[model samples]
Target: MPYKLSATLSAHSADVRALSSPTNDLILSASRDSTAISWQRATDQPGFVPSNVLRPSSRYVNSITYIPPSADAPKGFVVTGSQDTIVNVFALDKAKDEPDFSLIGHTENVCALNATPNGTIVSGSWDKTAKVWKDFKLAHDLKGHQQSVWAVLAVDEDKVLTGSADKTIKLWQQHKAVHTYNGHQDAVRGLALITDIGFASCSNDSEIRVWTFGGDLVYTLSGHTSFVYSLSVLPNGDIVSGGEDRSVRIWRDGECTQTIVHPAISVWAVSTMPNGDVVSGCSDGIVRVFSTSEDRWASEADLKEYEDKVAGQALQAQQVGDIKKSDLPGPEALQIPGKKPGDVKMVKNGSIVEAHQWDSASGSWQKIGEVVDAVGQDRKQLYQGKEYDYVFDVDIQDGVPALKLPYNITENPYSAAQTFLQNNDLPLTYVDEVVRFIEKNTAGVNIGTGGNEYVDPFTGASRYQASTASTGTAPASAYMDPFTGASRYISGSGSTPSQAPSSAHMDPFTGASRYSGAASVPAPTTNILPVTQCNTFKQANVAAMQSKLHQFNEGLQNEISTSSLAMYPQEVTAIDEIFAYLGQTIATPPQQPSVTLTAAHVEAIIQVLSRWPTSQRFPVIDLSRILTGLCPRVLDAPGLKDRFFEALFKASDWSDPWSPPPPKPRETNILLLLRTLVNSFQERAGLEDGAWPTRVFESLSQAPYAVLTKTQRVALATVLFKFVFSTKPRAPRPF
Candidate 1:
C-alpha cells in the first residue's frame, strides 16, 4: 500500500523490451526503438517524485541487466544490449554520457544480456552466437543457436542458459555451448534458473518447459493458446505466464489450471513481485497490476434486451412456472444466437451483422434502417465496377447504439505467408521472383555443391559453380552444402539450376566461387511447398506433439499448473505447493551458487596475472565470459554439474556457512581429485592437434581465472558446470 508508483518512467519511443532492477531502488529499461533509460524511485517522495529518464543510445536497447558490484562497496552499474550488435555498460553515478564499457563483435542484433560477479557481461545475438565481454573489449564468441538468440540467464556466476529463435535453449559453459534443449517449436523469450538443478523457460510456441543442466527434459506445462510472451517463476514453486491470447495464467506442476482476463494488449514483459502480485508491462505504454483478491472472472454479458427471451425459456412449468429465479441480481442471461452454447469465446468477441435489405419495389439494395433485438456490426458497401467489395463493416441490426467493426481489411500477404510457413514448414507457392530480387539487392550469392557451371539469374550466362551435393561441405569452389538438400541460389540468371562436375576435380584452397564473385553462401532452399495440405496439417500436429514430449523431457521433476495463484480454482496437490513457494522465494535471494577458486577457474587468471594485482586497466578481451565457464572444462578434470556444486559446497563457506566444514581429509581428497581431473581435461583439450573439443578447451585455458572475485569465481564455477556437464542435445533443423 505504501508504494505509490514510485517512478513514472517513460521507457522508450516504442515497446520496452527488457528491464532490470540491479539496484533495489533503480530500474533500467530497454526499448524496441533502440534506446535505454535509467530510472530511480525516490527514497523520500515528500520532496521530489521518483522519475526515470532516458540515457544515451543511438539504437533501441533490446536487453538490460545489472551486474552486482564486485568490490566491498556498492557499485552502481547497468549493462544494455542493443540492436546495433553492441553491449554498452554505464556507471550510473559517473560522468554524464560516459560508458564504462562498450563491447562489440557480434555480427547481428544483440537480443539478450546478463551481468556477472566479475565486471563482465554475457550477451546472445541474432548471429546465432553468445559472447562474454569485459571492460569494453571483445571476448570469445559462442556458436550455438541455429537462429537468433532471444534470452539468457547466468547458470551460476560463470555459465549461461541461452534461449534462441531457433526453438531451442543452449547451456553455455562460459563461451562454449555444452548442452542444448531443442524441444519448443516456438522461439524462447524468457528463462528463470533454480539453483544448480536447471531452469525453466517460456516461448512463443505457447508452452513452458523445464530442463536440467544435462539437457534432459524435466517436465512441461501447457495451456496457452497463443504465444507465451512473458513468464516468471515464483519463489513458491509456481509459474506465472502472460500470453498473446490476452490472459495471464498461473501454472503449478506443469498444467494450466486457471486463467485471468488479460486482453494481452501486447505484453512486453512480466515480473512477479515478492508479495505475489504480478506486473505486466504492455505495448500500450501502460503497466498493469493483477492480484488474487479481485480474481473474479467476468461472466459473459447478459444483454438486457434479451430479457423476454430468457423469461419465456425459464417458463414452461420449470419449477412451478419460472419461480422467483427470474428476479436475479445479475442481467437476465440470454441465449445468444450464432454461437455454440457454453462457449467462452462467444461472449468474449462475437456479434451478428445484418445484411442490407434488397428493396425489390425500389429496385435497389437499400439500408432497411435497422433490425430490432439483434447485436450487430456496422459495414459499408464498396463499389468495384460490377459487384461491390466490402468497404467496411456496418451494422443494420437495431438492438443497440453506434456500430463499429472489430477489424479492418487490408493486404497482408507477407504476414499470411510467414504464418503459413511457420505453421506447416512450407515454402511460398511462387518464389522465383523473390529469389531474383535478393540476388539484385543483397550480397549476390551463388549456391552450388559440386564444382560445375551455374547460369546467372540475370545474365543467363554459365558461371562455374559447385552443384548442390549430398555432403554440406562444399568443394573449395562451393558454398558449404549440407547433405541431400534442395537449395536456391540468388544467381543473376533467372530460374536456372547449377550443374555438377562430371569428374571430381577442385582446388582445395580456391574452394567454390560463382560468376559475379560470391562464395557459396548458405542456400535459401527449403521444401516448404509441394507437400499435400492434408499431410502437412497432419505433420504439423505431429510436430506439436513431439514438442510436448520434448517439453516433458526438459521439465524433469517439476511442473506448475497454469492458473491464477491469487484465487486458484483448482485443488492444489500436496507436494506441488512446496515448490510453488520455493519458486517465488527465489526472487528474494541473489540468484547465484557458491564459488570455489579452483585451478580451472584460475587458469584464465594468466591473462590478468600478467597485468598483476593493481592492473584494473588491462587488455580487455572476450576471455572474461569465456574463461568463467570454459577454463574449468579444460583446466579442471571434474566438470561443473550438480555433483560438482555439491562437492564445492563442502569446500567453501561462500554461500551459506551455517554448518561446520567437512572433515579435513575428505575436503582435501575431493579438491585433489578435482585437480587431477582438471589436469586430464587440460591434456585432452590442449592446443595440440587433436579433436575440435580439445582445440576449444586449449584456447580457453590460455587465459587465467584468478582475477575473478569470490562471486565471479562462483559464477564462473556455475557457468563451467552448466556448460561442461549439461547433457542436453539440440535438435537440428534442415534448412
Candidate 2:
C-alpha cells in the first residue's frame, strides 16, 4: 500500500493532547507529560525525528500553535499553553529546549491557543477569558464567557470565534463579541473554519454544528457518540472529527461518510495534511495517518493490528462478562414476584440481561445477553443501578415490605402492635416491650381505624389488620425504636409506671425525642452503637445503590459508542419515535379534529424541538396557524399552551453547542410566529399576561442581533418591541 506507518514519533511519557502542522513535512505535538516536542522528517533517515523538547515547567502542555515571523520575533515562534496557567513562546529555531518568553496572566490553566493572521496570538483559558497578545504584550482581554473557554479559532484578520464550557460560541471582532451562538448542551471543545462565511464547532455534547458568520445555525451533524475533542476541515471540504469515543469520523453533506476507530479510549486531536492524509493524536500516545485516496490504503500489517486489537477487546469483554455473570441473581436466588424461569429480565443493576430459571424460581441465569452488555461496556463495575431502580429494589428501613394490614380504629393498641410485630421481622423476644410501648403511646388514641389503615410508604401497600395482643396486660417498659436505635417507653404506663409527663411529645416516625422540659431526652447511649453500625451499613448500601443507578442510566444513554452512521443510536431511536408520534398527532386536515396539543404531546414536542431542523424529517405544522388557530383555543388547558411556547423557545435557542443557531428559514419562521403571538395578545388586551410574551422576550433578549445584518435584526427587534408594549397591563376603561 502507498500509505503505511512511516514513523512512530515517540518521546512523551503520557497521552498526546494536541497536534499542529507547521509545514507539510513538520509537525508539533503537546502532551499531558508536561512537554511539547517538535517533529520533522529526516531526508537522510527513513523516519521522522523529534528534538528540542520544550519542557517549560512541570505542567501539562494542553495546546500549541505556530506564530508567523514578525517584527517581534523574526524567526517566528512556537506558542504553547500549559496547566501552569502560562502561555510560553519559543523561538522556531531554538538552540535549546526552553521557552523564549512566558506570558503569564490567566489564573487557571490555558487550554486553547491560536495565532491570528495579524501576528497576534490568542489564548483561551480556564479563567473564562481569552487574551490577545501583540508585540509580546496583552492587547485585549476578551471577557464574556460564563465558563472556561475551551476553544478559540481565528477566522481572519479581524474576526475570531471562542467556544466555551457554557455551551456557547461567541464571535469576536477586535476583542468585542459581535454575536454569540448557542447550540451545544455541553462544553464546546473544538472549532474549525469551514469558509469565510461559515464555521464548525464540536462539543462534549457529542455532536457537530455548522454555522453562518452571522451566527445562524445551518445544520447539526450528529454521529459521534462521545465528546468531540478535535476537528479539521479536509482539503476536499469534508470535516473530520475525533473524540473520546476513539474514532475519527469523516462527514460529508451532514452525514458521517467514514469512521476510523482507534484502539484507545480517546482520539484527542485530528488534523489534515495538504496531501489529503488525516493524522490523529490518540490517547495511546501514537500518531496515525489515514489516507482517503484510492491509490493508498492501510497496509496489511496495519489492518492485522486492528483485527488483533478488536479480537483482544472482544476477549477482554468476554472475560469481564463472565465476572459480571457471577454478580447476577442465580437460579438459587429468588425471582421477582410472578416472574418465572426463562423470562428475560434486566439484572446486574439493569445492565446485564439475564433470564429467570424454572428450576431455581428464585433468581435468573446470566446467559447470552451478557455478551451484549460486555460489548457495550469496557469495565464490568464501571456503572451501577439508577436511583429509582434502587429505590424500587429494596424495602424501607424497618426491614418490613410494604404490606396491607386489617385493623379497627377501636381495636386494642396492644393487639394491633402484636399483629405488626408478628408480620414483620422483629424478634419474638421484644414482643412484650413493643406491646407496652404501643399501649401507652396510643393511650386515648386509636392508630387503626376506618381512616387509619397503615400504609407502607415505600411499597404503597396498605396494612388492614391489627396485631393480636399476647396478653391482656402490659408487659415491659421499653422497646427499641427501629429508626433511631433508642429505647422508647410508654410514658407513665410502662413496667416502671409513673404519672405521665405532659412536657414530652413522641414522634412515631423518627423516634426522635421531643421534650418541652428543661432537660431533653438524653441522646442514645453508647450501648446502642452495634445497632447503629448495622443500620449504617444497610443505609450506605442503599445510598450506593441509588448513586450507582443514576450513573449507569446516564452512562447508558451517553452518545459514545461504536457506530458510523449515528452517534447515539438510542437517542436517534427516541427522536424518531417522538417525530412519529407527533406526525400522527399533528398531521390532520387543518382544524378538522379538535387539534389540541396535550401534556404528552407537549412533552414530545419538547424532546423533538430542542434539536429541531436536525433529524426533523417530518413536515411541521405552519407556526402561524398553530399560534392563531390552535394556541388561543387551548390557552385554558393547564400548562398546555405555555408548554407549547416553552417548547418553541427551546427550539429557537441557538445556544446548543452541537449545531449552530437555526438558519434564516427556521429563524424567519420563529420570528413570524412571535409577531403573530404578540399581535394576538394585543388584540385580547390583558387576557393572557406573560404567557406568550415571556418566551418571545427571552428569545429576543439573547438573540445574536449583532451577528445578523442590520435589516434582519431591526425587523426582529421591531416585532419584539411591539409585542412587549402592546401586552403591558392597561388601565381599566373609565365607566
Candidate 3:
C-alpha cells in the first residue's frame, strides 16, 4: 500500500519526541516544548484539529502513551514522561491543562513510556532501570540493564521487552529477567511487537532485527543509513520504521518494499493509526499523517506543489556535471611512446544551467533549455562604466526600495553609495548621512576627517581645529568643535600666551628646558621609543623540576618492569592476606564491635585494592559487599558513619610514594559512593536528624556543577530525594 500525506499538524516549537492514539480518531503528541497536545479528527472535516494541550512537566516531555479506560479513570487517559524523571497520567476528560496524577520513582530522565493492556504503565529512564506502575503507585523495578534504558515495550501480560544503551534487549517476566538478547553493536533505540512469539528491534547501528520469544534471531532488516529511532507494525503485518536518515521504510518478508522520504532530518516517532494511517513525528516539530488508501487526502494544489518540488530536485541533480569515464584513474604504468591511447583523453568540467518552467498543462515542472559554461570560457558584462565577469538580476518590489549595488566587484563603497543615492532619487540632504551609513556598514571606506585640523575634501578648506593645539597665529573664531558643530575660544598655547618658534621644543624626558636661542640637542628627538617584542624565557627552576619528575617516573616504571616476578608474587600475597583477614572477620562475630575505624584499617583496604588485578572489578565489588555487611551492625553507632567516610577519603594511595600510580578521583567513583550511601540510608530508615543529607546538599551547592558528570549529578539528586525529601505515606488532609 502507498501512503499519501493526509494532514500536517505544526504547533510545536521543538522536536516532537513521541506520538500515540488514545482512540481511533484522537492523536496525542509529546514534544520538547514541555507539552502533550491532543489532536482530533473532526467529523466531516478534511484534517485533524488540535483539541487540547496538556503541560504537566516543566521540562522536555520525551514520551507519551495512551491509556484505555480503567476503574480509576472512567475515561481513557494519556501518560507523558519528561526530563523531570516523572510520569504523569492525564485524564481524557479533564481540563486541558494538567495531569490528574503523577508517578515518580525513576531518578533520571524518563525517556520512554508504554502502557500494558492491564492498566499497567512501564517507564524507561536514563537511570538504567524500568519502572512498572499500577494505579499511580510503583509496582516493580526492572533493574538489570548496565546502561540507560532507551525503549520499552509491553508485549503481553507475561512479557516486557526493554532496550538499553548497552546494546542489549532484555525480556522481563514479572519484573524479573527472562532472557537477555544481544546482537546490535550500538544502542538499541526502538522496539515493536510482531506477535506474542516474535518482535522487531532497531538500533543506532542502523539495522532492524527480528527476534523470537525464545531468544532466537529471525532476520536482520537493513535499509536505513543512520540511527533507527522508531518502529511500528502495520495492519498487514508489515513493519514501518523511521530514522535519522529522513526516510521511512516499509519492511515485509525481510525486505523494504516501500520508502517514504520526509523533509525533516530525523523522523523521531511513528505510530500506525487504527484506520491504517501512519502518523510520524519529526525533529522539524511537525506531526504528519500519511494514509495508505490515498483518495488524495491533500488538496490538488498541495499535491501539485509537492510533485513540482520533487521534479525540481531531480532536474537540479541532473544538471550537475557527472564524473565521466575519462576522469577515472589512469593506467598502472607510464604510457609507451606513440601508444594507441594517445595523450589520455580528458574531459573539461563544466556547470550546466537548466531553465525550468511550470507546465500548467501537465501540472508539473518541465525543463525548457540548458546552458553549459565550459571551463576557461569566461563570461563578462559591462555595467555603468565598469566590466564585471558576472551580472546578477536584482528584483525590486512595487514599493520597496531596490538594493543598488556595484556590478563590478572592485568598486569603492563610498562611490557606490553615491551612485545608489543618485539612482534612487534620494535628496542631497542625505549625502552626509549616506556617507556615514556606508562607512559604518562597509569595509575599506577611507572617507572621514583627517584630524582636528579638518579639511574638506571637496572644497580643500580647513573647517575645524583643536582649541588646545592652537600654536599657529589663527584667531579664536577660526577654530570650530566638530562634535558640537560650534566655534570655541582659543586657549593658551603650551602655557605661554606669546607663541614660540615652530621648531622650538623642550626635552621633557631629560628635565631640560628649551634654550632661548639654540635648538635642543637633536631637536628634541621626535622618536620616543620603538615597541619591541619581549623575549619571554622559560622558568629554569620549574623546567628542571618537571624534567626531574619525568626522570623519576621513568625510573620507577623501569624498576617495576624489571622486578615483575617479585612484584607479582608480593601483590598476590598481599591481596590474599587482606582477603583472608576480611573473610575471617565476616565469618566470626565479635562482641561489642568497635564503631571507630582508624587510618590503619583504611590503609590495609587501600593496599589490597591497589595490588589487586587491574582487569577484574572484584575490588570494587568486594568493597560494596563489605560496606553492605558492615552497615547493619553500626546502625546504633552515633557519628560512626562520618568517621567511616573520613577514613575512606584518607585511604587514597596518592600520598604513598610506593603505591603503584593512583588513578585520579573520578565522578564515577563519587556516584558509586552516593549509590551505596543511598541504599544504605534507605535500609536504615534514613539518617537520624537528617543532617547528612543537608550537609551533602550544601557541599553540592558549593561544588562547581561543570565538574560533575551527568550521572553524578543525577545520583546526587537521587540521594536527596530518597533521604531528605522522602517521607512515610500520609493520608490526604481535608481542605
Per-prediction TM-score to the true structure, in the order listed: 0.42, 0.46, 0.49
Error of 3 at 727 (Å): 51
lDDT of each: 0.43, 0.55, 0.57
Candidate 3 residue lDDT tens string, 279-340: 89976677988886667378878656544543342211122334344353332222222122
Q: In model 3, which regions exceed 4 Å deviation?
A: 307-735
Prediction 1 global C-alpha lDDT: 0.43
Ranking by lDDT: 3, 2, 1
Candidate 1 per-residue lDDT, tens place, 403-466, comes to 2111111212234223333432234542222222222222222433123222211112222222
Against the true structure, whose lDDT is highest?
3
Candidate 2 lDDT, tens digit per residue, 1-735?
A: 122333456676666778887565767888876788777767886446785678865867888888766676675678889878899989866556667778988877788988875667889987677888876688877776656788998877667789988788888786667778887988898999896549999987889999998878889988676679899987778888998655687787786655555655567788777777777786656666666454445556765666455323212233222445555654334344423322223345345443321212223332322223221112111001100101111111333222222332234434655555544323455444443343333222212223312221111122221222211112233333422334432232222222234433333444544423222222334455223111100001222222322222222222123112121444444433433433444454422333333344435444544443432211221322233333344344666666666555455443443233446555544544444444445444225655455655675566555454333354455554545555567775421
TM-score leader? 3
Please report how far candidate 1 places residue 400 from its true position, in Å. 54
Which portions of model 2 miss their true places by more than 4 Å?
1-7, 45-47, 70-75, 293-299, 314-735
